[model samples]
Target chain A: MNKWEDNKAWFLILPVFIIVAFSAVIPLMTVVNYSVQDIFGPGQRFFIGIEWFKEVLSDGRLHEALWRQLLFSGLVLLIEMPLGIGIALLMPKKGWGSSACLVILALPLLIPWNVIGTIWIIFTRPDIGLFGAAINTLGLPFDHTASPFDAWVTVMLMEVWHWTPLVALLAYAGLRAIPEVYYQAAKIDGASSWAIFRYIQLPKMRGVLTIALLLRFMDSFLIYAEPFVLTGGGPGNSTTFLSIYLVKVAVGQFDLGPAAAFSLIYFLIVLLFCWLFYQALQAVGTGDKQ
Target chain B: MARIDLNEIRHSYKPSPKSDDDFALKRVHTTWEDGGAYALLGPSGCGKTTMLNIISGLLKPSHGQILYDGVDVSAMQPEERNIAQVFQFPVLYDTMTVYDNLAFPLRNRNVPASEVDARVRRIAETLELTNDLGKRAAGLSADAKQKISLGRGLVRSDVAAILFDEPLTVIDPHLKWELRRKLKEIHKEFGLTMIYVTHDQVEAMTFADKIVVMYEGEIVQTGTPEELFERPEHVFVGYFIGSPGMGFLECTLEGDIAHVNGAAIPLEPGYGVRASSLGSRFKLGIRPMYLGVHSSREACGELPGFEARVVGVEDQGFCRIVTVQFGGQEIKARINDGHPVAEGLCWLTFPPEKTKLYFNERLVG
Candidate 1:
């Protein structure tokens, strides 16, 4: 008999498969089913074919939300990656202070997304919040409630504060993995500090930085709660992300047909981008390996 | 070429060295001739590596100065000192090809393309890495990567001295011999000053023209390989430089004879009196290769010789090592394979001419 002829071994994975099928596949099928039909109310439905998809494609709202989401994700990555790397570089290599710094950095990451948004919302109130009071005291008009530009800036700052630590922590782990021998060798080679950083530290961190970039891009593109709590999809929707917009369509308006269609489109877009990222990362990794 | 001078160099990591116990490295004053091969040999945690790093300008001395051809270079950076260092493990750029790894330092110095290619190709040939030059370093095995590291160091001829910190530890056993021979050949061809640090006695003995034996941060003895083997200045040196090491037994100095466990043993002339000024703790040191076995009737003098009980025997192809208990102490004796010896009681003798005496851990004669 073949060595792997024992089919009973698959029983071990049955529970996991069942859980994923119910939680992921079943829900996905329900959404697909809803996308093909128009639901007027509970128990009232009609086949709509691809009409909802066409409508969503030409909506123009999606185009605007996509543009905004892209800009937001780009801005978050640009600001967070370098700032995170810089903070990690400045951290002590080892000691009690390292543990202390780690705890302090992890605190923000552990906070619930909604709670973070609520905290920022209360903290940016011009009337009562310390930051808002300080800004107002400086004789500058800074109200995220009424100004679109202020709302955008507030949302961006809130995201940076809440997520920069994740990038920093990952970068720190990458940096720490590099052995001291490389640095010693570089020193003997007469490498300048800039050369050492550019050649050694940067190349060594490529793996971790790629992961950080992909994660930050996906999270920022789909950001909902923080911006929602801070501006409630913004002062005139200036800070509205794709996720919040989708939630509004699915729950607020209760248009299950259009909402399911919109969600499928959203999922496809994310999947496409993730696939692109994975390909790019594989290219870089294999190129280096060669 | 430069004659490096280390003038009264001392270092202690502690803030205050209240007594001799606090000094990580005691005061060491030495000089190296221009274009010489030196090996710093000692056990782990001995200050051999520390001294090498100091010479390479990685560590500043707590006191004194390092001078290269009469120019003070104590405060200089390693790059400024013009030294090439090979680490214990390979430290090549994993993202770069083997050729690119060798080309890095040359590019940093802005060397012309033709010269860089010629030099890199030459060192690659010496290291026997010509075929794999185009391959990425990450795909290569550990030994190949280390060979690349060695090539990177040797490619630059302008460096004042090349320092190797146990560079062959990652190499294969068979490759280590070939690499050491190649390094010896390269040193002969280039005539560059080389300082090799290793705890392995064989590598140091074969590679260095002058072996500097360090113990507890002090240069116990610095001499030619022959001098180190024939006459070790410190007990640690005698113990460290030989395979199976030198066997030492605690003894007392009584005039010209050394007494161990009430057994009188003859010593080389001018042995005990020479160390009389040094302190009380005395011991007799002898290499196993020199310690011989003799039948009771074959003995020549009344000088103490032990009828030792044979504990074990090791056949080392060319010779046999017999572990024997003499005067309540276990000692190893190297005998020719042809010698008739058994696993019972055997008479052992310490030849006076081959014996060394130590007083307070310092060699007497």
Candidate 2:
């Protein structure tokens, strides 16, 4: 009676395997094939062993962009996490007010990425837009099109506004999942507001916060559309992230071998960091036994 | 160490209650003395939990005052009231150690670290949680988590009261008995005024010095367990506090004689005036244990006897419950273990003084 008799379960997973093999595996193999070959034309090629890998690894431009990418992602996580939690806490808990607040707060996330960039471009025009004019009226020179610092600040502001809502929505869901008895018990025990937030609310939100961190990291690492539309790699490549630099190498210069090699390295870097983050989060969440 | 007085308390879930049905709790005026253990017993949705919450300052009564030691605290916050409560489900900080969980209340009040440590350890030792003090609270089982929840309440020496809201519903049955005994011992040792809320009659009877019986959001009786079982003020109290409960029969009383289906049983002469004023709704309640079964020839025949048909007999080891039909109704009779289950015709007698006459569900004088 204990012997396994169900072969039908295997058929249910076959579609997922086929789709992944075609979409991810096959294209990955093609990149691997291109990275190892020195192609002169469509039909002419020569086997080059690890030449492109070593050359791409030594490139100075890639190193600068990688460092810039790390800084941008780090800064994005730092600003968005706490801001999102604060917004979630401020939202109403019940009645029609809660629904109205949710609808208004979710408006920014629904806007397309390129549209967000376009909106910010017109919204900070210095002479015509309110944001730039207000800052200039305060006697501060604020033109995003000219200075590198101004350009970086505008881009950071746009990014924070565009994605903070996602983190806030996730945290709101986490807060709602806690039982009401915890708060009642905490109140009767004479716990202050800060202690309740630190112990009860924050610890309960760890699972969703982990998701928010991973999502914002992976999305910001691979960011392309918003910054591209806003800065266009800048007057001196001041705001050029890794993807922008990679696009310049792959499509602008069309150096097929080194570009393919760089693409594989970039993919591996993101994958390795994501794996490490998952491990660290799981370790903290599970905690330690006595 | 406080005497709690609730004066004319009424609560309604609606903004303006049109009738008594909208009120979750009717007007309740009662006092719990210092160092006394009391149980508020009722069925679900009977406002027992609402009463406990109002007393602990988690809720404020709509139109009344709560006084502790002659000081009005109805408008005060829960923290200002200096009370502790244990919920039905265990509520513990999942990341803290058991010792930290016990010390949470004291630490929040800015107790020194040394004193917090001493009190936490002392309570832990008393609750048999010393071995698990260093372990994560989240890693313990449900019963252990509940123990830590209770220990948090006991760590504070100056607390006015500790209220428990069905703290043992999630525990194993055998452990529930063990924890109940431990609670009794703690009550004796510390003399803390404790109020417990539960739906189980046995739990209320075993753990409380006084039992407050509530039904349909009304306080029906407040008495000792023996008083509640013997002289139940309302029909609900008699049915709610016993194993099989008292059996009630519809009857018409005219001049001290209660006529049940065609046979008449005499009651005390004082009931004659009250029974004449009663409407058509009247009943006579008698406990199952008082109803005796006898053969026709063996009775001395002073009491009223009726030929009853045996419907069913349930043998409950030490005792047996005999279900019979008489006077157009069914009543349960408890007999000794070896009592023969006689089928067909059997004479059933209800002793005169043990029988109680009810007018509008209230016992008569």
Candidate 3:
């Protein structure tokens, strides 16, 4: 009668193990094999233990890219979270208007990442685009091609405009999930609007907000295509992030050993940060409950 | 404390209600004196909760004037009316400590910290939640969370009234009576007007000084438990307020006697005239407890009764309920455990003082 007393159930998971071995484990092992070797053409290679890792770790270019990536992700989160919540609150709650709003907001999310970069790049051309021309007319020296500051601003703005709708959609779903009784009770309790939001709406939205946070962090950390198309890691390497540098080393120069080493370190950093974020978010409800 | 009055209140969720059936609450006009504990008792969909929400200013009646001490507050919000309410399920701020949850209302109104602390402590001690005050509300058991909700409502001194919508429903069966007793104690100590809504008659009877019975969005009978038990003004009250309910038997009455199944039976002395005026649609209503039963015809001589055949006997621990057939009609009689088990013939009687007459669902006698 005891289900866990028998160990035969372990065999049921053999198919899952085999699939993971072929899909994830094998590719990971190949990367691991390359990270420790100095590969010069397909056949000319020598095992150089830890040398590529040391080189990738010490390179100042990798260090600069990591810093830029962190700053970009942090700024993306800071702008998107509150703006998304505000938009969600402002959205119409019911009727055909709500559907229309949802469709409009989801349009950007449906577009391919590279297409988004292309659209923004064309839209920001001062000579031919309305957005760029309006800023030039406003007498702000706004050219992404020549200035690093302008380039950062354009990339940050593009990222925010593209991703904020996803946050809003998540927050709206969370808001709708709240029961009506909580709001009625709050009104009876003489709660101000802020108190109602703080105690009721925000707490109810915590689960979705945490999901949104983790998704934004991971996706923005691994972002490559959109930035690569927009700036091409150029204008004096101002917006060069980890993913672009990794791609440049792996595909452009074809330095397989050093790029493999860089990728392994990059994977660990992403894994470590994501794990930390997940833990911190989960602890919000549990730690404060005591 | 203030006298609360609902004047000609009626509500319909439909915008263009054309008939009585469309309204959820119809033409309610009643007043509750300040500091009185009252219960609104009814079945589900009887609009008791709707009336409570209207009184607490959560829902405005489509046609009514809700007056607090003669001041019309029909358009005021719940907070403006200064009321507190406990819902069917406990609604505590889950992330807050019990102390903070209790202190929220006071803190919202910008009360001094010392006053908030003293009030919170007083209510927590009363609700037996002092030890758990420092603990997070989300981590506590359901009943403990419910106690925190009750404490939050009670902690504020400026509240006009407190409403409870089946607050004891989620509590364990054994704790229900204990919490009911605690609520009664709190009611007496505070002298605050409390409106408790519930579908269970026993809960209403035990807790409230006045029980308002509602049916089909209308107030049927409002009386003390004794009055409701003894003289139910409406037929629905007779059926809803008692276990096993009152039984009705078709009958025709002349001056001082009634004929049932072509057999003559004397009516109660004072009720004969009122009973005689009723139309042919008359019924004699009596509780099963008051229906007299005897094992043989010789047991009751010359008293007008039914000679019936015993069908079944249900021994209910302390009492026996005997079901009998008379004139092709089925009726049950409750007897004490000492009554002998009857075999074939039995006599059923209606006590003159206890029996009542109804004409078209309205009590006549």
Candidate 4:
């Protein structure tokens, strides 16, 4: 039997394509156009053909900022992933206590990034802040604006405090979705608590942990507001990460071509690292299957 | 292996259970012999799972001791007790290989690597998972995954008993048979005390040497499959054990005869004396297979029978289940395909020897 078929169903995706074109494609194309041309003003421009890319790629400051960004992302994942999972594990399974803990954990995440930085700045002020005053009172020289080490510490603390809750929430959800029977089976199988966590809990949380890892990695890689407001990339560029450094190039020096080229490289780097993390996580889950 | 005893065990989910109804398991007082296969047979929420968990040391009874080999283990953790359990669904570690999943129990107990490998391999071979031992457990089919879950239990040779809580519910019908057969073979080979929990009567009958029938949180009866069918200790056992179950009619006893709505049905001698001494009205219970259905009074011949209206006839391929309204109550009667069946009106003969008397939902001795 021949059935009547209409090709009009294909048109349903047109709206999505239109939205994506305006939201991502157009902006990306403009950035690409700016990266390849030298513009002195609104109407005067010359196609430079890869010169900006070469210049951005070879800049020593960009390389240093790239290294710094990599280190920051690495530390964020290293600290946040385990810390988040640990907190989630320690959280109450159910009851008013569980809800209370969840609300408290979400408090840091709900604060705006720049507001979090300001809160931390006041929290760590040497003259008036709790942490800064306490450290100086203890005979330690603590000033985020004066010392690079102090600035890096203050920025790292703010970043971890502001974002660890996201990872914790994801891990908590993963932990909760596991069926109770696994724990029962493990207990009856004579598994120790640590073994149960390693075999049952950890493996079951793989999907959410993968998401958490990638999200935290990308978010930390693109971090700007909190660190910028907290230290303003001060103390001699100690905390001038890739995003902060890029903002300096684009808005501070107003180097449109180089900044556009830098933005494209940054996007590629984030995409590449996320892909690598996802593949690694999936391989661990699938074992020798693929 | 150990003989597990539930010494008057009772449990309640409520914090302060003041009455019997508040208890999930009102009372479960029975002993499971060592090296014996037993099934906790019951409908859902009949305390079968509660009993199984108590025996496995997963749930502590609210009142009473759980004894393993004459030692109290009521307060012990599941891991502290030498037991293994499989849940209704397969609970294999998703990221581990089949071999690793099987070896996990032994490894956690600090078993030597060489011994763990040998035991894991042997169990895998027994479960016919030797070929797939290196594959991750998550990629396996549901039946294969269940086999892995069973293998994890089987790998530990020193387990006091292995409890299965409807482990075949997740398997396909064809695979269920194979897996059940494997379990029976494992039980026979190991001689491990096994307690299986299921609401499926056929599964209970075939898998267990003894069936503990539960009803409304009480152990109504415990007996061999034949005893459960032929001499049910409780009305519930008679009702729950058979294919088309037992038919019950409210009646009063009078000198080896049971009167149901002015109709008298003969019973075995001494029932009248015993039921009278007990001094209460009782019920007449008979299995569907034994309740003979005839077309006419002449067909009943020398034996007395009651008149009933044929409500429906269901053909079950090999036999027919005749539903009849007898004495203002609906009851079923099973007839062979070769037997002549009546339409609209029929006579039901309760064979004197096959009939049972029940007093207050319990068998009259």
Best by TM-score: 4
Taking the tens digit of each residue's C-alpha lDDT, what string does model 3 give over B217-256?
9998999998888888888998897777777777777766
User: How good is the docking of model 4, by CAPRI class?
Assistant: medium
Report lDDT (CA) for all predictions. Answer: 0.86, 0.88, 0.88, 0.90
Off by over 4 Å in 3: A1-11, A288-290, B252-259, B269-278
lDDT by residue (tens digit), candidate 2, B104-198:
99999999999999999888988889999888888899889999998987899888888999999998899888888888888999899999999
Better of 2 and 3 by TM-score: 2
lDDT-superior candidate, 2 or 3: 2
Instruction: Report the interface RMSD that candidate 3 achieves against the true structure, in angstroms.
Output: 1.6
- Residue A248, candidate 1: C-alpha displacement in angstroms: 1.9
True contacts kept of each: 0.49, 0.67, 0.67, 0.79
Judging by lDDT, tell me the better candidate of 2 and 4.
Answer: 4
Task: Enumerate the candidates' DockQ scores in order.
Answer: 0.50, 0.68, 0.65, 0.65
Per-residue CA lDDT of candidate 1, range A1-290, in tens?
Answer: 55757789799999999999999999999999999999878788899899888888787877788889888988998999999999889899999989999999999999999999899888889999888878989998899999999898889889999999999999999999999889988888777788788878888998998899889988988898888888888787787789988898889988788889999999898889888887887666447433
Root-mean-square deviation of Cα positions for candidate 3 versus the true structure, in angstroms: 2.2
- Over the full model, what C-alpha lDDT does candidate 2 score relative to the true structure? 0.88
How many pairs of residues collide in model 3? 0
**Comparing candidate 2 with candidate 4, which one achieves the higher DockQ?**
2
Kindly list the per-residue Cα lDDT of model 2 for residues A1-290, writing each as its tens digit: 58778899989999999999999999999999999999999899999989999999999989988998999999999999999999999898889988997888799989999999999888887888789888999999998889888988988999999999999999999999999889999999999999889889998999999999899999999888888888876747878998999899889999889999999999998998889888998776567666
**In model 2, what are the clashing residue pairs, if there are any?**
none
